[model samples]
Target: MSEPFPTIRRPADRTQMILLFIVLTAGLAAGLAIYSSATSFITFIRTASSALFLPILLSLVLTFLLEPVVSFFERTTGKRTGSIFIVYILCAMLLYLLMQFIIPQWQSAWNSLQADLPRYIKGMTNYIRDLGLKIEAQTPFIDSADLVERGRSLGKDIVNTVIVGTPQSALRLGGLFLMVPLFTFFFLRDGSRILRSCISLAPNRTFEMVHDLSYLITKQLSHFIRGRIIEATIIGIVIFIGLSFTDIRYTGFLAVFAGVTNLIPYIGPLIGMIPGILVALVDLGIGGQFWWIVIVYFLIAQVIIDNFILIPILISRYSNLHPLWVIIAIILGGNAYGILGMVIGVPIVSTLKIIFIEIRQYRRTFSLSERLPESES
Candidate 1:
């Protein structure tokens, strides 16, 4: 009996196969070139859109945070506009209090730090010198004086850079603060209608899938943002209360900094503690008990409280992503868009994961349906 399928044996068949291979290789090269161009174009577009639409983007984020409250108020009042106005009033009062109390305190602390910069630098130099002396005792080649000088120069450079950058940063922030509220108002008012309109654009074949996907993604994003805000607030309050017991200068500012930085997973808490440690070293000396206190407190608050308690309850349940993947996402995000990228990376990755799972399930269902007729026949 002959084999059901014969291997290629003819010269012409071999020539045809070789030609097919060459064609495929050329087509693949062309496809890769096109993909590369598309990627570059997408990057350029993203950069432009980020710059142009930052306020709108921020407003959308704010809408996500405040929408539930708005809806609750709307349910009670039976008026969306009235609910939004009420929320706006409440926000204004909160902002006023922040301006009256927190901003001044933070500004005063900042000013004090600036006024005492020279002293901090001198203290830091002395700390480095003392530490370097011990090292020098162990290693004769170590130069305490050089170490002290380098530390002093680094301290001065950091202060100078911060001083130089503040005005530009403030101006940009002021613009954002002004624009975000206006955009947020519109988004809060029309968000549902907008979402419905977008969903309506999907074809009937995929309409149900699109609708479900949209709801799932939106719910996930809203939960993530609100949970993060709550987590940051809790962390900030805890840090502030903890630091208030110690003689740390700028306790509130440091607490706020820690809370904000806590948004970036893994590395954020570490960075948040830098200013606190530097401040402690300046105020209480390098070898003081307060140094240990600050370090221990940060470790407990950030690593233990955040990683073990808050994250598990607030974020992990919703995302259900692995720690390794989270770290990888943070690294990629940090590389791509700096701090903003780091803040958003995990959520973006989680969204992608959801889409992938949904797609896989869809394909499996499709395949099973196709196989049913064949199996029956």
Candidate 2:
């Protein structure tokens, strides 16, 4: 009867099950503790401005973006340091040229925007008053005068903020700008050494796994950053070109705003719309439903193209994340790291996924003590 079909399990099997459960439970507790501590550390590090750590972190991010160019130059020159300098110099020149050509237009648009603010507010208020008149018979709650007063107060506050905030913002940015390139140079020059040092921390059994995990994270991360940058550029250019053909005021500013905000995901596009909406309402003279229609149509069109066409073509190819997970990652990252968190959240999550996958794949390759029966161990 085939030994009674081995109907009863061995005591060894029960011991193995207990060991597995204990191991899993311990691991879960450790993981949660580690995660909490890591986030706290990250938050602390993010607040430091004078620290080399911030620059080093920024360099790592830029390295991922500029690795290809650096590699190409390295191959041609056979000198990593030389390649980095050449790339930096080239970047400086390109930036200078771009600023030379584009800054004037931006300056002009900004001035125009500033000058038009009060007039725009007045136009909007007058239009609202007209509309309120039409609706006042039916709705006694409509108050155009109150809205006008509030609008002017808001405009004045915005103007004051621009006047006071720009200097501080520029000063902070200047410090980061200097630090980023300085650190990026070192990272580009000695990145392999850095990687080697990090990999050295791994156990002998996981040396190969560590190497492969690093490669996987770097590959996916670079792809994601490159894709995001290209996507932003494309979106900006599309908006610029589309608005150029339309009658939108401050096209350059609006395009730039949209592109920059597009980095934040989900909430980004809506924030981008704020500036555009404000500008459109001002230019279109409020009760101009035709221009409102145009704005709505443009927004809908951009949404369709961004979600259906550009996203799949650009970002989805690199990170196969579901929208729900992405939204959650953004929220968690934002809560933990603020803007930087939101920006790096998806890539961070993707890298974590890769690490876990590597861990699982190599789990069996570890010592058999845990995998074997207690008697065998």
Candidate 3:
């Protein structure tokens, strides 16, 4: 008799089918929600956009950055509470010094510009007339008066707009300023607990992979943020000194703007130069000397910072990305969300690049396995 037929059960496809159903349902729900949101959104996006989020984002980034420091403190003190308390105290003191000392000096410089406006305006007018005379002497046919009048009209338009809009903008800004510190304090206090709670919910099968990615993201983000602050601070101080040496009247204000803009990566240097050049033009008028000297200073400073400072740090940390990719990311980000996007685009791109690399590696290994010859049976 033939061996008794044993029951053979086919592998259940239920698990995969359930997963596919869940994914499809989620996708459909997301699509519907997004469509509804697009159709019925009620908030003014600009008003909704707040710097209140900045401190929270900064605190989250800071928590990661200072995690090692906090951990060291914990190790020495043998208590997490002590570590957090000590770290927070130091951070608070630093912030207080920045607000009390640095900001006041910067504000003083700004006030000086406002006070010396009449002198600056007179110097500018004389310089412009001299330029007009030289141009008329060189090309005795062109309408110099029309050109000068148009320039004055444009300046008046810009000044008028600023004067009209500033108070409203300030009121909006005051609201966010009130909110940022509160958000930051909570983020700093609870960030680790929040992270751990989020991590705990990840599926067991994917936990290790997720944890590794989390660590990588933490490192990359912290490095990028900390490096940016340091670089911007250094650039701002250098610009202040360089501009003060020159005859540009708004040196301090321009330098501070440049430093703040420098946080935006590749596009930052170009953006930072605009205020400097404009102030230089306004101060010395439209003369070749003013333009040439301002351009030269900007070029020299950018060269020094780009080659000597950002190169070594960025090249090693973001060796995976190309300059072309960086530029594309900046442009896309700027178009999508303006300055904030430009500032954050490169770091976001770097994170995505890491994820893409891992995915590609996994796919390649899987493909190789499928292509290999089977053993003889």
Candidate 4:
């Protein structure tokens, strides 16, 4: 039929293919081993240097947040030292005001909370017993007495845990507060020089790539950290204002708790709501008008303000993460480091994504250039 197409065949390099496969497999196994060892070494180092870690971490965060202000001041004064000094003075004043005004309210709210906690627990227990009886009346299988007993046991355990942990937590926090400013000052002063020194160590071939990667990573982290702090502050203020209208006890403390917990994504807002709702239920009866008002306020704060306005404006653009990946990262982080893991998981994953993307782009460009020469030839 039309002299048929010549059967095109190529010589098979089975022996070469086998050797190539072996080499690739061996390389992959070696790479995995090396990676595992490096990870273990890094983890060991981090654990060994754990005491120095927190202050450094907090300093870096403060540096990121305050860098723009410092930069602006530097531009105006033409002296980096003066810029940092001015910013330091401003920060000191801010801290002084916080200590004078905000701390007192928070302390008062906390003391009130501690004093009323036992009474609140007892009231909740009674409420639960009554509710359980009503439920048991409706459904014979329900055991209200057992439920009340369990609730009481849980409340007691919570109180005991808080009492046991508070002093240690306070001591650690006080030490951190003292160390963070010193570290932050040095970081602000020498951050640029340190970055250049790090980049200079990279090979010539990777020099530009490393520079770009460092800049991109730093910029991304700065935007994220600064945005999160602003977002948390705004949310705290909104919560405090909203709760002020309600009869909630410890509004300042509850708002502060909510703000702190908001660092964890997705479930953070829900976690923040728990204490407020529980207190509302204990103070103002469950299913009452005020209880409903408290729930509605939280909904408006989270769904309307946070989801619609704050997130879109501040976080969403920088994060650019898919919801599924965010959830997975949070889960993995929480599993690895508990609350701290959950807080940092997204940023870590985002940084890795940036590295992956940059490498992929570099390879693609290299491949395209190689093929262009071949095509020209």
Best by TM-score: 4
Clashing pairs in 2: none
Off by over 4 Å in 3: 1-38, 41-55, 61-72, 98-105, 112-178, 284-300, 314-342, 345-347, 354-377
- What tens-digit string does per-residue lDDT give for candidate 3 at 1-377? 89999999977699988999999999999999998887556444444443434445555655656767877888899887678788878978998988897787767765675555445444445566678889999999886775466556655665565556568767856764566545544555576677778887999998876776666655665665666666677778877777766677666677777887776656677888876775677666667757654654466567767557665765345434677888988888778666667776775686677656655655687687877765322
Candidate that beats the other on lDDT, 3 or 4, i.e. the better one: 4
Candidate scoring better on TM-score of 1 and 2:
1
Error of 3 at 52 (Å): 5.9
Question: Once superposed on the true structure, which residue ranges of model 4 sit more than 4 Å away at CA?
Answer: 1-46, 122-150, 287-297, 318-332, 350-377
lDDT of each: 0.80, 0.72, 0.67, 0.81
Candidate 4 per-residue lDDT over residues 279-350, each given as its tens digit? 887777666646654654467678887888998888746365777888998999889766767877776786
Q: How many angstroms is residue 140 displaced in model 4 relative to the true structure, after the best TM-score fit?
A: 6.2
True-vs-predicted CA distance for residue 165, candidate 4, Å: 1.7
User: Model 3: which residue pairs collide?
Assistant: none
TM-score of each: 0.74, 0.68, 0.64, 0.76
Model 2 residue 280 distance off true place after TM-score fit, in angstroms: 1.4
Ranking by lDDT: 4, 1, 2, 3
Give the RMSD in angstroms, all C-alphas superposed, for model 3: 12.1
**Comparison by TM-score, 1 against 3, better one:** 1
For residues 1-377, write the lDDT of model 2, one tens digit per residue. 45566577656788889999999999999999999999988877766642554466677778877889989998999988888889999999999999999999888877777778677656656666666667776777765456556666776777777768778868867987998898788788788798899999999997887887787666666776777777777778877776676677787877877887776666667767776766666666456553653454356435766777777876744355657877888899789766667766765676576556555645655555566777675
What lDDT score is found at residue 79 in candidate 4?
A: 94
